[model samples]
Target: MNTTPAQLPHALVMIRPRSFGSNPQTIGSNTYQQTDEGLAEEEMNEQARKEYDDMVAALKKADITVLSFDDRTDPVCPDAIFPNNWFSTHPDGTLALYPMMAKNRRTERRQDIVDYLEAHYELKQVVNFAPFEKGSRFLEGTGSMVFDHTHGIAYACRSPRTQQEVFYKACETLGYKGILFEARDEGGRLIYHTNVMMWIGSNIAALCLEAIPEKQRNEVLTSLEASGREILLLTQKQVNSFAGNMLEVSDPEGSPHVVMSAAAWASLDSKQQELIKSQAHPLPLSLDHIEKYSGGSARCMMAGIHLPLKPGATP
Candidate 1:
């Protein structure tokens, strides 16, 4: 395997859901979300938990450090498993909390997670964008924007959950140049999250160019070209299978691995799989139950830990 780049984090933070199900607040915007008519709510929750455990196990087996936490029931959050939306950590010792569109999702943010990070990592600063929620403006963490930290570029598509003004402000705060564009689904609806249609790694980027408008598509292509990344074009059908919702991470030894769902893996053609394998090792986790109901895949479940470790802190 090749040496891992700065864009690939060595550790991840994942929340195991106790009451996982379809979120009513997010279903409207999230066109990818679907309901399993056969399963009861309780059965769905059990399946989600099992899928979560299986995913964590697969990740750990690949030598990735996973900081796992259980969801709280005090204020029930059905979409709590998708932790990448709430907050993000940076290599510059910065922790940022984002403004969520759904009222129920706002409760996913936990003080304990912040405290634990501060205790173990070198957290130099904390930036909160949650105040924007009061004005009904939102810019979800990694969900709304995909950061190519290696090149200091933030790629985002215009959507209800991703306000342009807030996105630009976030880019300015993080010292990144923002690349904003319009991407719509097949039915002419805006894709809720940018991550669902694109994923950027060290040298490779998978994107669904078909979803983007012709006029604004060139800008995205130009930016990726300027970064010298090899682009992999994905069809809308493949994207619906969660093909673009992939994350590149690394093990402690700096071996790069592309974490994705089994469905995503199956969606890829043989040639595409070969190209991906040449870039990094593919680690596919079975998440049919979780992906079918919640509308998110492997990338959404993991919040990458980019902060540096503190003195004497164990990995």
Candidate 2:
């Protein structure tokens, strides 16, 4: 990655949910992607499109450029809408492809998508971990870990989708310090992804204290504080509402903004809202239908494009 000051990206890549719905393969771990037998497939797709359009419009209105891609339907990548789980780009023009735990989710990784991105931006390196899928060990990109890029710190909660060995290898390759721990929800099941429990920005962090074990909570807190970051504590209920699934991006004007789903934004109290607002503008998008079946919110829908632009390419 780039050895420069850490900041939110000015561009984002969002995949349209062409074939969106709950996946039986992921239902065991993604508690949020609950299927509704009553809703017709046509109606569900319409609702999903409306939500996706609204979110894209909102992000663009905030002066954040969006590179939108339509999800393919051939084999039906159900969770294709949540693109951040497959790959992530860095400031130094490094692109990392992660190994997904879900058999179906692995299909979400497409070479054409990366080629389309490269057509507009300049990426210096490609870190491929998809080969590790043969061993069954996985690291679901940013979905499995919340990165504090500025401090080179990675906060991840161990789960079926996030293995420690894979996590450490990725961190080691990226030169980040890994802080691994177990985090459980109210039902005592492990939270599938850390982004749903912890979110780290340039100098701010939002985390669910209840998710982390009591013994390990202090260590996480200390690490954040030592990194010179202000904390916004979230409750388990809030985390369930996707409160911790927020992403920070920059407007074309160069101002920082925090983006989240309306459901996630609504879960926060006035105090918590005020604290976050002090750092960046909150772009609360309406994505009710998408969140209902995809098990991901605004952050997961957006894969920030931080790679340096190729010659003659606009930012």
lDDT, each prediction: 0.92, 0.86
Give the Å error, residue 214, model 2: 1.2
The runs of at least 3 residues in candidate 2 whose Cα sits more than 4 Å from the true structure, single-residue gaps closed, are 1-5
lDDT of 1 at 25: 92
TM-score of 1: 0.97
Per-residue lDDT over 187-244 for candidate 1, one digit per residue giving the tens place of the 0 to 100 score: 9999999999999988799899999999999999989888888999999989999998
Off by over 4 Å in 1: 1-4, 36-38
Candidate 2: the clashing residue pairs are 2-92
On TM-score, the candidate that comes out on top is 1
Estimate, for each residue in 1-315, the C-alpha lDDT of model 2 and write its tens digit. Answer: 222236576688888888787778888888877875678878888898899998898888887889888988776888898889999888767899999988888999989978877887887778998888999999999899888877778889998899999999999998889999999988999999999888887768889988888999999999999988799999999988999899988776667889998999999999999988888898998888878877888899888877877777774
- Model 1: lowest-lDDT 10 consecutive positions: 1-10
TM-score (C-alpha) between model 2 and the true structure: 0.96
